[model samples]
Target: MHRDLHAVTFDCWGTLIYEPKREQGALARREIFRKCLQQHGVEVTEERASDALREVWLRHWREWQAGISSDATDMAGWGLEAFGIHERAAVERLGCELAEASLEQEVRALDGARETLEQLARREIRRALICDTGYSPGRVVRQLLQREGLLEFLEVLIFSNEAGVPKPNPRIFQAALDPLGVGPEQALHVGDLRRSDIAGAHGMGMRSVRIRWQNDDTSDLPDAHAVVDSHAQLRELLHLDGS
Candidate 1:
Protein backbone atom coordinates (compact mmCIF):
# COMPACT_ATOMS: atom_id res chain seq x y z
CA MET A 1 0.00 0.00 0.00
CA HIS A 2 1.15 3.54 -0.67
CA ARG A 3 1.47 4.84 2.88
CA ASP A 4 1.84 8.47 1.83
CA LEU A 5 -1.63 8.56 0.30
CA HIS A 6 -4.79 6.83 1.44
CA ALA A 7 -7.30 8.02 -1.16
CA VAL A 8 -7.72 9.61 -4.59
CA THR A 9 -10.60 11.95 -5.35
CA PHE A 10 -11.62 12.91 -8.91
CA ASP A 11 -13.86 15.32 -10.70
CA CYS A 12 -16.43 13.67 -12.94
CA TRP A 13 -17.10 15.47 -16.23
CA GLY A 14 -13.95 16.86 -17.82
CA THR A 15 -11.48 14.77 -15.90
CA LEU A 16 -12.78 11.22 -16.12
CA ILE A 17 -15.30 11.52 -18.96
CA TYR A 18 -16.12 13.68 -21.92
CA GLU A 19 -19.72 14.35 -22.85
CA PRO A 20 -19.53 14.76 -26.64
CA LYS A 21 -22.24 16.06 -28.91
CA ARG A 22 -23.21 18.51 -26.22
CA GLU A 23 -25.62 20.24 -28.58
CA GLN A 24 -27.47 16.98 -29.20
CA GLY A 25 -27.70 16.28 -25.48
CA ALA A 26 -29.17 19.72 -24.91
CA LEU A 27 -31.69 19.08 -27.67
CA ALA A 28 -32.74 15.77 -26.16
CA ARG A 29 -33.42 17.47 -22.84
CA ARG A 30 -35.33 20.30 -24.46
CA GLU A 31 -37.53 17.87 -26.36
CA ILE A 32 -38.36 16.07 -23.14
CA PHE A 33 -39.44 19.29 -21.52
CA ARG A 34 -41.34 20.32 -24.61
CA LYS A 35 -43.32 17.09 -24.51
CA CYS A 36 -43.85 17.32 -20.78
CA LEU A 37 -45.35 20.77 -21.11
CA GLN A 38 -47.58 19.58 -23.92
CA GLN A 39 -48.94 16.85 -21.65
CA HIS A 40 -49.67 19.42 -18.97
CA GLY A 41 -51.79 21.38 -21.47
CA VAL A 42 -49.29 24.19 -21.75
CA GLU A 43 -47.84 23.72 -25.22
CA VAL A 44 -45.09 26.19 -26.02
CA THR A 45 -42.44 26.81 -28.63
CA GLU A 46 -38.97 25.32 -28.31
CA GLU A 47 -37.55 28.81 -27.91
CA ARG A 48 -39.83 29.43 -24.94
CA ALA A 49 -38.70 26.26 -23.20
CA SER A 50 -35.11 27.10 -24.05
CA ASP A 51 -35.58 30.52 -22.54
CA ALA A 52 -36.86 29.04 -19.33
CA LEU A 53 -33.96 26.59 -19.15
CA ARG A 54 -31.44 29.35 -19.79
CA GLU A 55 -32.89 31.48 -17.04
CA VAL A 56 -32.73 28.60 -14.59
CA TRP A 57 -29.12 27.96 -15.57
CA LEU A 58 -28.32 31.60 -14.87
CA ARG A 59 -29.79 31.29 -11.39
CA HIS A 60 -27.66 28.22 -10.67
CA TRP A 61 -24.57 29.96 -12.06
CA ARG A 62 -25.03 32.77 -9.59
CA GLU A 63 -25.48 30.32 -6.75
CA TRP A 64 -22.37 28.42 -7.74
CA GLN A 65 -20.31 31.61 -7.92
CA ALA A 66 -21.39 32.27 -4.35
CA GLY A 67 -20.15 28.82 -3.27
CA ILE A 68 -23.66 27.39 -3.13
CA SER A 69 -24.77 24.34 -5.07
CA SER A 70 -28.19 22.90 -5.91
CA ASP A 71 -29.17 19.67 -7.64
CA ALA A 72 -30.01 19.54 -11.31
CA THR A 73 -33.34 17.97 -10.40
CA ASP A 74 -34.13 20.89 -8.16
CA MET A 75 -33.19 23.32 -10.90
CA ALA A 76 -35.37 21.38 -13.31
CA GLY A 77 -38.29 21.65 -10.93
CA TRP A 78 -37.76 25.35 -10.52
CA GLY A 79 -37.63 25.85 -14.28
CA LEU A 80 -40.84 23.89 -14.78
CA GLU A 81 -42.54 25.69 -11.92
CA ALA A 82 -41.85 28.98 -13.66
CA PHE A 83 -44.18 27.79 -16.40
CA GLY A 84 -47.05 27.04 -13.99
CA ILE A 85 -46.49 23.31 -13.44
CA HIS A 86 -46.81 22.28 -9.79
CA GLU A 87 -46.67 18.47 -9.74
CA ARG A 88 -43.61 17.69 -7.69
CA ALA A 89 -43.33 14.03 -8.70
CA ALA A 90 -43.91 14.80 -12.33
CA VAL A 91 -41.32 17.56 -12.34
CA GLU A 92 -38.70 15.33 -10.78
CA ARG A 93 -39.43 12.55 -13.25
CA LEU A 94 -39.07 14.94 -16.16
CA GLY A 95 -35.86 16.30 -14.71
CA CYS A 96 -34.43 12.81 -14.44
CA GLU A 97 -35.58 11.91 -17.91
CA LEU A 98 -33.64 14.82 -19.33
CA ALA A 99 -30.48 13.57 -17.65
CA GLU A 100 -31.08 9.96 -18.69
CA ALA A 101 -31.03 10.99 -22.33
CA SER A 102 -27.32 11.86 -22.12
CA LEU A 103 -26.12 8.45 -20.92
CA GLU A 104 -25.11 7.25 -24.39
CA GLN A 105 -21.96 7.66 -26.49
CA GLU A 106 -22.56 11.37 -26.31
CA VAL A 107 -21.33 10.99 -22.75
CA ARG A 108 -18.25 8.74 -22.77
CA ALA A 109 -15.23 7.93 -20.66
CA LEU A 110 -12.19 10.07 -21.29
CA ASP A 111 -8.93 8.60 -22.51
CA GLY A 112 -6.86 7.05 -19.72
CA ALA A 113 -9.89 7.19 -17.47
CA ARG A 114 -10.20 3.41 -17.35
CA GLU A 115 -6.47 2.83 -17.12
CA THR A 116 -6.18 5.11 -14.11
CA LEU A 117 -9.13 3.57 -12.33
CA GLU A 118 -7.82 0.06 -12.92
CA GLN A 119 -4.39 1.02 -11.61
CA LEU A 120 -5.95 2.51 -8.49
CA ALA A 121 -7.96 -0.65 -7.97
CA ARG A 122 -4.90 -2.83 -8.47
CA ARG A 123 -3.10 -0.82 -5.81
CA GLU A 124 -6.06 -1.11 -3.37
CA ILE A 125 -6.25 2.64 -2.94
CA ARG A 126 -9.60 4.16 -2.02
CA ARG A 127 -11.34 6.19 -4.74
CA ALA A 128 -14.07 8.81 -4.79
CA LEU A 129 -15.69 11.41 -7.11
CA ILE A 130 -16.66 15.00 -6.45
CA CYS A 131 -18.72 16.87 -9.04
CA ASP A 132 -20.91 19.92 -9.44
CA THR A 133 -23.90 18.64 -11.38
CA GLY A 134 -26.50 20.86 -12.96
CA TYR A 135 -27.16 19.41 -16.41
CA SER A 136 -27.07 15.83 -15.17
CA PRO A 137 -28.15 14.80 -11.69
CA GLY A 138 -26.19 12.42 -9.47
CA ARG A 139 -28.32 9.37 -10.30
CA VAL A 140 -27.71 9.65 -14.02
CA VAL A 141 -23.99 10.37 -13.58
CA ARG A 142 -23.71 7.25 -11.44
CA GLN A 143 -25.43 5.24 -14.16
CA LEU A 144 -22.92 6.48 -16.70
CA LEU A 145 -20.09 5.26 -14.50
CA GLN A 146 -21.85 1.95 -13.92
CA ARG A 147 -22.31 1.51 -17.65
CA GLU A 148 -18.65 2.17 -18.28
CA GLY A 149 -17.54 -0.16 -15.41
CA LEU A 150 -15.96 2.71 -13.46
CA LEU A 151 -18.46 2.83 -10.62
CA GLU A 152 -17.15 -0.29 -8.87
CA PHE A 153 -13.81 1.25 -7.94
CA LEU A 154 -15.33 4.43 -6.55
CA GLU A 155 -16.00 4.13 -2.81
CA VAL A 156 -17.63 7.54 -2.44
CA LEU A 157 -19.68 9.85 -4.66
CA ILE A 158 -20.01 13.54 -3.76
CA PHE A 159 -22.12 15.83 -5.90
CA SER A 160 -22.77 19.52 -5.41
CA ASN A 161 -26.43 18.91 -6.06
CA GLU A 162 -26.61 16.60 -3.08
CA ALA A 163 -23.88 18.25 -1.03
CA GLY A 164 -25.74 21.59 -0.97
CA VAL A 165 -22.47 23.36 -1.80
CA PRO A 166 -20.28 23.35 -4.90
CA LYS A 167 -16.54 23.44 -5.47
CA PRO A 168 -14.10 26.15 -4.28
CA ASN A 169 -15.99 25.61 -1.06
CA PRO A 170 -14.02 23.66 1.50
CA ARG A 171 -17.19 22.24 3.07
CA ILE A 172 -18.01 20.05 0.07
CA PHE A 173 -14.55 18.52 -0.18
CA GLN A 174 -14.37 18.21 3.60
CA ALA A 175 -17.46 16.00 3.43
CA ALA A 176 -15.48 13.29 1.64
CA LEU A 177 -12.65 13.04 4.19
CA ASP A 178 -14.78 11.48 6.94
CA PRO A 179 -16.22 8.76 4.73
CA LEU A 180 -12.84 7.74 3.33
CA GLY A 181 -11.27 7.92 6.81
CA VAL A 182 -8.46 9.99 5.31
CA GLY A 183 -7.17 13.38 6.29
CA PRO A 184 -6.44 16.21 3.86
CA GLU A 185 -2.75 15.35 3.70
CA GLN A 186 -3.50 11.74 2.83
CA ALA A 187 -5.76 12.58 -0.12
CA LEU A 188 -5.01 13.69 -3.68
CA HIS A 189 -7.57 15.42 -5.89
CA VAL A 190 -7.54 15.42 -9.73
CA GLY A 191 -9.71 17.66 -11.79
CA ASP A 192 -9.78 19.89 -14.91
CA LEU A 193 -11.33 23.08 -13.60
CA ARG A 194 -8.86 25.26 -11.72
CA ARG A 195 -11.48 27.34 -9.97
CA SER A 196 -13.48 24.50 -8.50
CA ASP A 197 -11.54 21.24 -8.28
CA ILE A 198 -8.01 22.49 -7.56
CA ALA A 199 -9.04 25.40 -5.39
CA GLY A 200 -11.58 23.40 -3.43
CA ALA A 201 -9.18 20.59 -2.60
CA HIS A 202 -6.37 23.03 -1.82
CA GLY A 203 -8.66 24.98 0.44
CA MET A 204 -9.30 21.77 2.38
CA GLY A 205 -5.52 21.07 2.57
CA MET A 206 -5.42 18.20 0.06
CA ARG A 207 -2.72 17.95 -2.60
CA SER A 208 -4.32 18.84 -5.94
CA VAL A 209 -3.58 17.90 -9.56
CA ARG A 210 -5.17 19.78 -12.42
CA ILE A 211 -5.51 17.71 -15.61
CA ARG A 212 -5.19 19.86 -18.70
CA TRP A 213 -7.10 17.88 -21.32
CA GLN A 214 -7.68 18.69 -24.99
CA ASN A 215 -9.64 21.82 -25.80
CA ASP A 216 -9.54 22.70 -22.10
CA ASP A 217 -8.16 26.20 -21.92
CA THR A 218 -5.99 26.72 -18.84
CA SER A 219 -4.68 30.27 -18.57
CA ASP A 220 -3.83 31.96 -15.31
CA LEU A 221 -4.08 28.56 -13.75
CA PRO A 222 -4.68 28.20 -10.03
CA ASP A 223 -2.02 26.81 -7.70
CA ALA A 224 -1.98 23.02 -7.38
CA HIS A 225 0.55 20.40 -6.34
CA ALA A 226 0.90 19.50 -10.03
CA VAL A 227 -0.57 20.09 -13.49
CA VAL A 228 -0.91 17.04 -15.71
CA ASP A 229 -2.24 16.42 -19.19
CA SER A 230 -3.63 12.91 -18.78
CA HIS A 231 -4.52 10.31 -16.18
CA ALA A 232 -1.35 8.43 -17.14
CA GLN A 233 0.69 11.35 -15.86
CA LEU A 234 -1.37 11.35 -12.68
CA ARG A 235 -0.66 7.66 -12.07
CA GLU A 236 3.01 8.24 -12.71
CA LEU A 237 3.05 11.26 -10.44
CA LEU A 238 1.61 9.19 -7.61
CA HIS A 239 4.41 6.65 -8.24
CA LEU A 240 2.20 3.94 -9.72
CA ASP A 241 4.63 2.43 -12.18
CA GLY A 242 2.24 0.70 -14.54
CA SER A 243 2.52 -3.03 -14.33
Candidate 2:
Protein backbone atom coordinates (compact mmCIF):
# COMPACT_ATOMS: atom_id res chain seq x y z
CA MET A 1 0.00 0.00 0.00
CA HIS A 2 1.09 3.59 -0.61
CA ARG A 3 1.87 5.50 2.55
CA ASP A 4 2.45 8.96 1.12
CA LEU A 5 3.25 10.26 -2.30
CA HIS A 6 5.74 13.08 -2.80
CA ALA A 7 5.14 13.21 -6.56
CA VAL A 8 2.84 11.52 -9.06
CA THR A 9 4.49 10.53 -12.32
CA PHE A 10 2.50 9.24 -15.30
CA ASP A 11 2.68 7.50 -18.65
CA CYS A 12 1.47 9.43 -21.66
CA TRP A 13 -0.21 7.14 -24.18
CA GLY A 14 -3.12 4.84 -23.33
CA THR A 15 -2.92 6.20 -19.80
CA LEU A 16 -3.52 9.92 -19.50
CA ILE A 17 -4.15 10.44 -23.26
CA TYR A 18 -4.42 8.32 -26.41
CA GLU A 19 -3.94 8.42 -30.12
CA PRO A 20 -7.09 9.57 -31.89
CA LYS A 21 -7.67 6.38 -33.88
CA ARG A 22 -8.81 3.01 -32.52
CA GLU A 23 -5.89 1.09 -34.16
CA GLN A 24 -7.57 -0.83 -36.91
CA GLY A 25 -5.45 -3.94 -37.49
CA ALA A 26 -4.98 -3.75 -41.24
CA LEU A 27 -5.58 -0.05 -41.50
CA ALA A 28 -2.47 0.74 -39.46
CA ARG A 29 -0.39 -1.15 -41.99
CA ARG A 30 -2.01 0.62 -44.90
CA GLU A 31 -1.51 4.03 -43.39
CA ILE A 32 2.16 3.34 -42.78
CA PHE A 33 2.60 2.03 -46.31
CA ARG A 34 0.79 4.99 -47.85
CA LYS A 35 3.06 7.39 -46.05
CA CYS A 36 6.19 5.38 -46.87
CA LEU A 37 5.36 5.37 -50.58
CA GLN A 38 4.53 9.06 -50.51
CA GLN A 39 7.90 9.75 -48.95
CA HIS A 40 9.60 7.97 -51.86
CA GLY A 41 7.77 9.96 -54.57
CA VAL A 42 5.28 7.20 -55.25
CA GLU A 43 1.59 8.08 -55.45
CA VAL A 44 -0.90 5.42 -54.44
CA THR A 45 -4.44 5.30 -53.18
CA GLU A 46 -4.98 4.42 -49.53
CA GLU A 47 -7.03 1.33 -50.40
CA ARG A 48 -4.48 -0.13 -52.79
CA ALA A 49 -1.51 0.55 -50.56
CA SER A 50 -3.15 -0.82 -47.41
CA ASP A 51 -3.69 -4.28 -48.89
CA ALA A 52 0.04 -4.84 -49.21
CA LEU A 53 0.90 -2.99 -46.03
CA ARG A 54 -1.52 -5.10 -44.00
CA GLU A 55 0.31 -8.29 -44.91
CA VAL A 56 3.67 -6.70 -44.19
CA TRP A 57 2.56 -5.36 -40.83
CA LEU A 58 1.02 -8.66 -39.86
CA ARG A 59 4.24 -10.50 -40.49
CA HIS A 60 6.33 -7.99 -38.58
CA TRP A 61 3.94 -7.80 -35.64
CA ARG A 62 4.20 -11.55 -35.15
CA GLU A 63 7.97 -11.53 -35.52
CA TRP A 64 8.58 -8.55 -33.29
CA GLN A 65 6.45 -9.70 -30.39
CA ALA A 66 7.33 -13.37 -30.67
CA GLY A 67 10.96 -12.77 -29.78
CA ILE A 68 10.70 -9.49 -27.89
CA SER A 69 13.30 -9.14 -25.15
CA SER A 70 13.33 -6.94 -22.07
CA ASP A 71 15.91 -4.64 -23.64
CA ALA A 72 14.76 -4.67 -27.24
CA THR A 73 13.90 -1.41 -28.92
CA ASP A 74 10.12 -1.33 -29.30
CA MET A 75 10.23 -0.35 -32.99
CA ALA A 76 13.55 -1.72 -34.09
CA GLY A 77 14.17 -4.46 -36.71
CA TRP A 78 10.61 -4.35 -38.06
CA GLY A 79 10.79 -1.56 -40.59
CA LEU A 80 11.76 -3.19 -43.86
CA GLU A 81 9.94 -6.49 -43.45
CA ALA A 82 6.79 -4.94 -42.06
CA PHE A 83 6.29 -1.99 -44.42
CA GLY A 84 8.72 -2.51 -47.34
CA ILE A 85 10.27 0.75 -46.18
CA HIS A 86 13.48 1.10 -44.22
CA GLU A 87 14.88 4.45 -45.15
CA ARG A 88 15.49 6.62 -42.10
CA ALA A 89 14.16 9.65 -43.91
CA ALA A 90 10.99 7.78 -44.84
CA VAL A 91 10.45 6.62 -41.27
CA GLU A 92 10.60 10.19 -40.04
CA ARG A 93 8.05 11.22 -42.65
CA LEU A 94 5.71 8.42 -41.56
CA GLY A 95 5.97 9.33 -37.89
CA CYS A 96 3.07 11.72 -37.92
CA GLU A 97 0.91 9.75 -40.33
CA LEU A 98 -1.42 9.10 -37.45
CA ALA A 99 -0.92 12.47 -35.82
CA GLU A 100 -4.54 13.26 -36.52
CA ALA A 101 -5.55 10.68 -33.95
CA SER A 102 -6.12 12.03 -30.45
CA LEU A 103 -8.80 11.86 -27.83
CA GLU A 104 -11.91 13.84 -28.62
CA GLN A 105 -11.99 17.20 -26.90
CA GLU A 106 -14.48 15.99 -24.33
CA VAL A 107 -12.57 12.89 -23.10
CA ARG A 108 -9.14 14.39 -23.40
CA ALA A 109 -8.54 13.96 -19.70
CA LEU A 110 -8.16 10.23 -19.22
CA ASP A 111 -10.25 9.07 -16.29
CA GLY A 112 -9.62 12.19 -14.22
CA ALA A 113 -6.03 13.21 -14.92
CA ARG A 114 -7.24 16.79 -15.09
CA GLU A 115 -9.21 16.53 -11.88
CA THR A 116 -6.50 14.62 -10.07
CA LEU A 117 -3.85 17.06 -11.21
CA GLU A 118 -5.93 19.98 -10.05
CA GLN A 119 -6.36 18.40 -6.66
CA LEU A 120 -2.67 17.54 -6.36
CA ALA A 121 -1.58 21.00 -7.42
CA ARG A 122 -3.41 22.42 -4.41
CA ARG A 123 -1.81 19.81 -2.14
CA GLU A 124 1.93 19.46 -1.41
CA ILE A 125 2.43 16.62 -3.91
CA ARG A 126 4.47 17.35 -7.05
CA ARG A 127 3.61 16.04 -10.53
CA ALA A 128 5.68 14.80 -13.48
CA LEU A 129 5.28 12.90 -16.75
CA ILE A 130 7.49 9.93 -17.70
CA CYS A 131 6.16 8.74 -21.04
CA ASP A 132 7.23 6.30 -23.73
CA THR A 133 8.39 7.57 -27.09
CA GLY A 134 6.14 7.40 -30.12
CA TYR A 135 6.34 8.89 -33.58
CA SER A 136 6.30 12.45 -32.29
CA PRO A 137 9.14 14.12 -30.44
CA GLY A 138 9.07 15.18 -26.78
CA ARG A 139 8.06 18.66 -27.80
CA VAL A 140 4.84 17.27 -29.23
CA VAL A 141 4.21 15.38 -26.02
CA ARG A 142 4.65 18.62 -24.10
CA GLN A 143 2.31 20.31 -26.54
CA LEU A 144 -0.37 17.72 -25.88
CA LEU A 145 0.04 18.17 -22.14
CA GLN A 146 -0.21 21.91 -22.58
CA ARG A 147 -3.28 21.50 -24.77
CA GLU A 148 -4.85 19.51 -21.97
CA GLY A 149 -3.67 22.19 -19.52
CA LEU A 150 -1.47 19.67 -17.72
CA LEU A 151 1.88 21.37 -18.33
CA GLU A 152 1.47 24.13 -15.75
CA PHE A 153 1.16 21.64 -12.92
CA LEU A 154 4.04 19.30 -13.79
CA GLU A 155 7.59 19.53 -12.45
CA VAL A 156 9.05 17.55 -15.38
CA LEU A 157 8.11 15.61 -18.48
CA ILE A 158 10.60 12.87 -19.41
CA PHE A 159 10.34 11.22 -22.81
CA SER A 160 12.43 8.17 -23.81
CA ASN A 161 13.43 9.65 -27.13
CA GLU A 162 14.65 12.77 -25.41
CA ALA A 163 16.47 10.94 -22.64
CA GLY A 164 18.05 8.24 -24.86
CA VAL A 165 16.92 5.45 -22.58
CA PRO A 166 13.69 3.48 -22.39
CA LYS A 167 11.92 2.61 -19.14
CA PRO A 168 12.48 -0.60 -17.12
CA ASN A 169 16.01 0.68 -17.42
CA PRO A 170 16.45 2.52 -14.11
CA ARG A 171 18.20 5.42 -15.83
CA ILE A 172 15.06 6.80 -17.48
CA PHE A 173 13.14 6.65 -14.24
CA GLN A 174 16.06 8.32 -12.49
CA ALA A 175 16.02 11.07 -15.10
CA ALA A 176 12.42 11.85 -14.19
CA LEU A 177 13.26 12.06 -10.51
CA ASP A 178 16.51 13.97 -11.02
CA PRO A 179 14.71 17.20 -11.72
CA LEU A 180 12.35 16.79 -8.76
CA GLY A 181 15.13 16.64 -6.15
CA VAL A 182 13.49 13.61 -4.55
CA GLY A 183 14.51 10.02 -4.03
CA PRO A 184 12.75 6.91 -5.35
CA GLU A 185 10.70 6.09 -2.25
CA GLN A 186 9.18 9.55 -2.24
CA ALA A 187 7.71 9.20 -5.73
CA LEU A 188 4.70 7.22 -6.95
CA HIS A 189 4.39 6.27 -10.60
CA VAL A 190 1.10 5.71 -12.38
CA GLY A 191 0.91 4.09 -15.79
CA ASP A 192 -0.91 1.43 -17.83
CA LEU A 193 2.03 -0.67 -18.96
CA ARG A 194 3.10 -3.25 -16.42
CA ARG A 195 6.49 -3.94 -17.90
CA SER A 196 7.73 -0.43 -18.43
CA ASP A 197 6.05 1.81 -15.89
CA ILE A 198 5.03 -0.42 -12.97
CA ALA A 199 7.95 -2.80 -13.04
CA GLY A 200 10.41 -0.04 -13.67
CA ALA A 201 9.16 2.05 -10.78
CA HIS A 202 9.26 -0.87 -8.37
CA GLY A 203 12.72 -1.80 -9.53
CA MET A 204 13.92 1.58 -8.36
CA GLY A 205 12.06 1.47 -4.99
CA MET A 206 9.33 3.92 -5.95
CA ARG A 207 5.67 3.04 -5.44
CA SER A 208 3.56 2.23 -8.48
CA VAL A 209 -0.10 2.27 -9.54
CA ARG A 210 -1.36 0.39 -12.56
CA ILE A 211 -4.13 1.87 -14.69
CA ARG A 212 -6.35 -0.87 -16.11
CA TRP A 213 -8.30 0.79 -18.90
CA GLN A 214 -6.64 -0.80 -21.96
CA ASN A 215 -4.65 -3.38 -20.06
CA ASP A 216 -6.92 -5.71 -18.06
CA ASP A 217 -4.25 -8.20 -17.14
CA THR A 218 -3.69 -8.29 -13.38
CA SER A 219 -1.64 -11.45 -13.27
CA ASP A 220 1.72 -9.71 -13.54
CA LEU A 221 0.89 -6.62 -11.50
CA PRO A 222 1.43 -7.87 -7.97
CA ASP A 223 4.11 -5.28 -7.29
CA ALA A 224 1.86 -2.32 -7.97
CA HIS A 225 0.87 -0.44 -4.83
CA ALA A 226 -2.61 0.18 -6.23
CA VAL A 227 -4.82 -0.38 -9.25
CA VAL A 228 -6.82 2.52 -10.63
CA ASP A 229 -9.37 2.40 -13.40
CA SER A 230 -8.96 6.02 -14.40
CA HIS A 231 -6.71 9.03 -14.03
CA ALA A 232 -9.29 10.53 -11.64
CA GLN A 233 -8.31 8.00 -9.01
CA LEU A 234 -4.84 9.55 -9.01
CA ARG A 235 -6.12 12.24 -6.66
CA GLU A 236 -7.38 9.67 -4.21
CA LEU A 237 -4.14 7.71 -4.44
CA LEU A 238 -2.32 10.84 -3.41
CA HIS A 239 -4.82 11.13 -0.52
CA LEU A 240 -6.30 14.34 -1.83
CA ASP A 241 -9.95 15.34 -1.73
CA GLY A 242 -11.79 16.54 -4.83
CA SER A 243 -11.14 20.10 -3.66
Specify the highest-TM-score model's number.
1
* TM-score for each candidate, following the candidate numbering: 0.89, 0.75
> For model 2, what is the alpha-carbon lDDT of residue 126?
78
Candidate 2, residues 79-192: lDDT per residue as tens digits? Answer: 433545567655544544433222222225565677777777788677788876643447666777788777788888887667776677788889889888889989888888
Best by lDDT: 1
Model 1, stretches more than 4 Å misplaced? 1-3, 214-221
Question: 88-111, model 1: which lDDT tens digit per residue?
Answer: 887888877876777743677888
Query: Residue 103 lDDT in model 1?
Result: 73
